[model samples]
Target: MATTGGARPYRPTLRAMSVVTFNVSGVEPVQGTFDDLGTPLHEVTFVVFDLETTGGSAREHAITEIGAVKVRGGERLGELATLVDPGTPIPPFITVLTGITDAMVTAAPKIASVLPTFLEFIRGAVLVAHNAPFDVGFLKAACAELGYPPPANPVVDTADLARRMLTRDETPDCKLATLARVFRTPNQPCHRALADARATVDVLHALLERAGAFGVHTLEELTAFARAPSPQQQRKRHLAEAVPRAPGVYVFEDARGEPLYVGKSANLRNRVRSYFTAAETRPRIREMIGIAERVRPIVCATALEAEVRELRLIAAAKPRYNRRSRFPERVVWLKLTDEPFPRLAIVREVKDDGCAYLGPFGGTRAADDARTAIHEAVPLRRCSERIGVRTRRPACALAGLGRCGAPCEGRETPEAYARHVTAARRAMTEDAGIVYAAVKARMDRLAAEQRYEEAAVDRDRLAVFVRVAARMQRLAALTRIPQLVAAAPGADGGWDVHVIRHGRLAAAGVMPRGAHPVPYVEALVATAETVVPGPGPTPAASAEETECILRWLETPGVRLAQVDGSWSLPVNGAGRLLARIELAYQGRDERPAREGRPLR
Candidate 1:
């Protein structure tokens, strides 16, 4: 053997020891299997392992010994013990503490050779260690050094489980020695790998016995029991047990069957189960789960369908925990009233009073931004007071500042004011060229004079208007169609079909894989839910629903299968305005350095 810097070089031993397997008290080790939630905890195999290393840090040290015991149903199935020849010398302090001297591992196999056999022993079993991260971290580091990928094994830390299962009065601490004494294990940890591993097995069994009182009978439930179990969560674990492991929507309902919350997930079982774990940190979620008496799962063929269904359920049930789309009718709209002056106004209820409506805005702020942009460009009356054609009312300060046409003061005739209203309505509904041109001219002049900050502000305002205008134009074109059918290839090998009636999603269903969609489409349309327009002027579709439909229709691969009415953007639509806005804001951050330079 050669020596370097007071450390012995790793040597391959002729007495190469492969992994040792033995049964404890004649009980054979059962092979481990996948973690199925349905599997009973007693049937699952656990490989409780531990490591003795040259130093505390896995990254800076090397393993000197490895020990593990495989157990199932409170019976020991197998055991493994091996000493590893660490490439570096074991520190004197570590040797004294663990009683593992340098000579003990002199001719032992190197970690690279021992790791493969150790991994094979623990394969198919849930890895358990006193403080798992330490042993697992060293194993991972060794694998990395050997250029092999680490094993994807589920790990359980007895220290963490002990903390949750044992009371302070019972153990006083989660240390392996403390737990060994409290549980009165046959094997006491002596700072050696095999001894510590044996002690961990006993600790694991003790914790499992304690966990049974909490109704934890499965491996999934046992792992979750590591977290501090709330009384409410422990009582409601059965609610998630019946949820299917499929993409779907899950509704949490109260005792009266009223929905408390609605959520979508790719895996209903896992997502619903997460509510009982410590991972769920939302305070509102904790409160909701506390009161939830039942969970209902509606399986969907695809995630997209799940999302759409979640939105619909949220809107219909108005779940107390859901904050979005609960009141779709509350969305604000910028309306051009049918009065003589036709001032821009924010209204929630859409009516058929022959007025030009611009949105289904998500909030008042966006609609207010559009209103300000349009008012600034076109001099429509800014006053809110009703002024008839015959009535004469004094003008406000806006008239003197030339911000309004002063229709109340009769400074502008009815016909003249009508023309201004027409231009504003055209900008809102038909074409935004006039407004865009005015804002662009002002932005250009400001930038030319080196008013960069003001220019940026105007540019942002113009962008808001352009985006809203484009959205309104697209929505209006869709609403004009009496009936429309659009289909897109779903991720799950089917076509997701949507039927739109009066701009609302009347019906939606999936065309099965490898099946003709014609009959399905016809049946879906005929049996579609009827959304009647209210006696007032509101659209049959809510803004949230319309936006959802529009987003789907605009997806890249979506195709319009059939159109019962015209569906086309106007030739002079606000689409071009969007392009102009994009051009104006491009490279805006670099504008400060390029001030006084002409915009391309």
Candidate 2:
């Protein structure tokens, strides 16, 4: 090897060293395909385990020892054991049972350094412990803090196996000691994990033989039978029984009565009960049970109408316990200024003005999104400045950028920019159909000029318009509102007119009983009969008729349509006038009306 200035070049050595991860168990096969003692016992592919703990209860104790034996097809292959010095005072009761004093394990390695080796040894084996969950739960809790996924392998609880095999009369309470005594298995110092594990293994051998005779052979069957009645299930059953069955929304409360969960059903009782008995579990439901102290139900109308009422209540209450619904209310409006050069601004909140307002969007975000969109579509000067941009000697930054069209600098004519702004506003607020057509026209021109890249951009913009149009079409499919025309009752006095809109029965309306029971769809259809559709609403309808139609459409169930599609009206003087102008519309574009405020 070449040497540097004063340092010798490093030489690497080629040496292979085999390192075994860990010994699985102390039992070793000394006979033909089996351990010298156990039987035609095929090596039981299991993680035979024991845990030395500071106390008896798994909940409040820490493990102080661990040991295991790995067996495959009834043949013991390896052994591993460790005395963990649990960093806690070992109780006198535990000390007497296991004979493992705190002093004995003081020199042993800490759990942090030993667990990795232990896990490696048991990697492919089904964990087997006497009363497995107690040990397993403690081990898993330890494992969790280390970011380990809890063992996915089945855990075979030997305690359960012993009880199933032993005669009830001979041994009713199958304690490890009792079973050890009955089976003649030697009792090593009980709490010493390794010695106890050895005793458990002996008991396991006998139980396997007993279980095999009764045809309980597979690992799956063994584990399933073991995990039947955990304390968690009993708790869930108690909760389910407490919820009342009724027509209402059930609120699951934590100890504080702060709603942790809210759910509604036709049969409150049945729905609440379903959570307890169901085999398939929802993690959230399990979480609720962990903290829940009480269940409360608030009665409501029919189940069919629960969703609507639920939304109203949730919106009003803004409950911390209830998760917010994904679909939120949006409210928006189009603002038309009273200035000489009128500017339209899409706003989340509408201002009182002589000009029109379009909507209260279903949600604040939706309305804000709409505002951003309209602003981008129409880059008109919506600033507080009263003077025309072109009239100024020094143009603002907007004019400096091409966005202003240099009208402020007088490079572009005021009339031309105004025309463009008008077109842009129309495309944004009233309807996007105009914007789509304009973009389509520009795209055609670009393609004709062989500007493919520019044409592609236009194509993308057109796609956006198509998407918006499709969404609008879908919205229209779900909602149908016709112009409302006031009507008289039929001869029989039973209401017969078709209601095109949902009308509230105000005290001023007919039916002195003050009942606004049924909404009048006929009113909406009759109102649509007044507007003649072409470029816009007709001059005749624009006078007083337009106001009537707009007012009626502004009602809850009625929405204003830019174009009147179709309608049916009675043949009265007002109806006759409406029929005549049903298709007539003013060529001028009307600004969208301003609703009260954005739907927050």
Candidate 3:
């Protein structure tokens, strides 16, 4: 069915999987339907390692020894143990503790040379360490000094895992020595690198065995479990039990029945479950979960529907936890005032009063910058006061400066001023080549005079003008089409069809596998909402909604079934102008005194 502004569409709310089951162990049984939970632990390769350094601080010390054991599926693939030359004398106390004298590592290779070999040994594996901060920090510091990018591998700290899983009955402390004794592995730690690393691997297996009872089998679960989630999160894990494992928007409503937050995901169950797990690291979400009393899932047939619905829901509800897409009114527009001596004006609202508009700019600053660029290009008056055709007033200093034609004092006739208004209107909508040329030439003039900073400001303003003009014109083209029928390839050998009228989503549905799309398209178009054209580019829909439709149309596999109008931009339009302006911006920062300016 069709939905207008703030209206609900008729779609399936997945309720078939809402039946709850009891688990004696008090753990929510892990479901296979949650596909976004990352790689399984057994399928992941792990490099369990330990490092011995000269000091605790990575910034102030050097690594003395490195030891690693690479394992997958309880089988050891390889081992790396190497001594590194500290490049300084070993302290007497350290030599006595680890039983390594200064002469012991004299023949060893330097850290810079050995780092590459160690990195290759642990390539494409999860790094496990006793206290990861001490080991990983030193490796990162060394990589920075040598001008190599830091390793992009996932890390698991056995110390933090042990703290979250075991109690005083299991072990009094989370230290490697205590865990090694509790697990009673073959290897014992005696201040040696390889032995301690081997002991850590044994403790890691023991912790995993304990975690299995709590449904922590995946790597994503393992990392989140290490964060020691709050008690409230555990108690509220049942809220996600009724959520369908489908693409949709989920609202977290407080006890007062008001939405606390709104979010959308391809897999609703998996994403909502993550909020109660340690995987959700946002503090605001954590707070929202505490106040939320129920999970309301609105399942959709496709992710695009979920996205559009989420935007509208957030805008209507103004949920406290959601910071974006809530206040469309805050966006300002730059419209040419509909007057005898028309000028560019920043307006909070768009009206169908036969005026040209350039925006729905993000803020006043952007609209103001676009206004300045238009004035620079078109020689429009800058005063805020209104001027009449018959009334005579004193001209401002701008007339003497030759920036204005002195229309206020009748020095410039109404017919003459109308020409500038026409140019300004053209710059805002149909074509932007004139504005681009004028701004670029002025920027070039500034750069030639060694005024590089001032020229850069002009470059930024021109960029703003180009981007907004292109966006508004593109939206204008879309909104002018009375009705558009399009289809995007669905994931399951089907077609996701949409009916858009005046750039607003009128109706949407998905055709099943091997089903004919012609009937589906015909039925949707017949049942689609009727949208009357409003003034300006975005009529029935917000500028954001029209842009969303434009993006969906541009996606790779979309096919246009029908369009009411030409539904195309001018051959020479803002798109081409934006490209040339971007090139000038690229060279805007360079030295102006060197030679040729970038505007040409």
Best by TM-score: 3
| Model 3 misplaced stretches (Cα beyond 4 Å) | 1-146, 149-226, 584-600
How would you encode candidate 1's per-residue C-alpha lDDT over 1-600 as one tens digit per residue?
111110222222224233344579888865533333345667778899999998888766789999989977677788999999986678899999999888999999998889888889989999999878888999899899898789888888888777656666787778999988887877899999999988888777777766666667677877766655556777898999999998899999999999999999989999999998787745468668889999999998656567778888998899999988787767788888877667888998777687888776778888887787787789988778777887687888888888877777678898988888889888887888777778778878887788876876766766778787787777667766778888998756888888887777777778889987788889989988786654222356655556667887888999988898687886777887676567765654333334522323
lDDT of 2 at 416: 70
All candidates: CA RMSD (Å): 16.5, 23.7, 16.1
lDDT of every predicted structure (CA atoms): 0.78, 0.52, 0.81
Tens-place lDDT per residue, model 2, 386-410, is: 6464365555677656555645456
- RMSD value for candidate 3: 16.1
Off by over 4 Å in 1: 1-235, 245-247, 277-279, 300-305, 448-453, 490-494, 513-516, 533-538, 579-600
Record all residue pairs in model 1 with backbone atoms less than 3 Å apart, i.e. clashing: 350-537, 351-537
lDDT of 3 by residue, 1-600 (tens): 112110222222233543355578989865444245466676678899998877677765678888899876566678999898977666778877777677889999899999999899889999999888889999999899788899999899988777667755878888888887787766777777887888777777777766666667678877776775756788899999999999989999999899999999999999999998877745568668878999999998777778888888998999999988999878899989988788888998889798988888999999998888888888899887888887688888999989899888888888999899999988888778888888888887888798866887887888898898899889989888899999998878898888889889888788888987788789989998888888877888878878887899999999999988888897667887876766765643233333433665
TM-score order of candidates, top first: 3, 1, 2
Look at candidate 1 and tell me the lDDT of residue 83: 94
The true-versus-predicted C-alpha distance at residue 340 of model 3, in Å, is 1.5
- Give the lDDT of residue 418 in candidate 2: 70
Off by over 4 Å in 2: 1-247, 277-282, 326-347, 350-403, 406-425, 428-430, 438-600
Per-model TM-score versus the true fold: 0.58, 0.38, 0.65
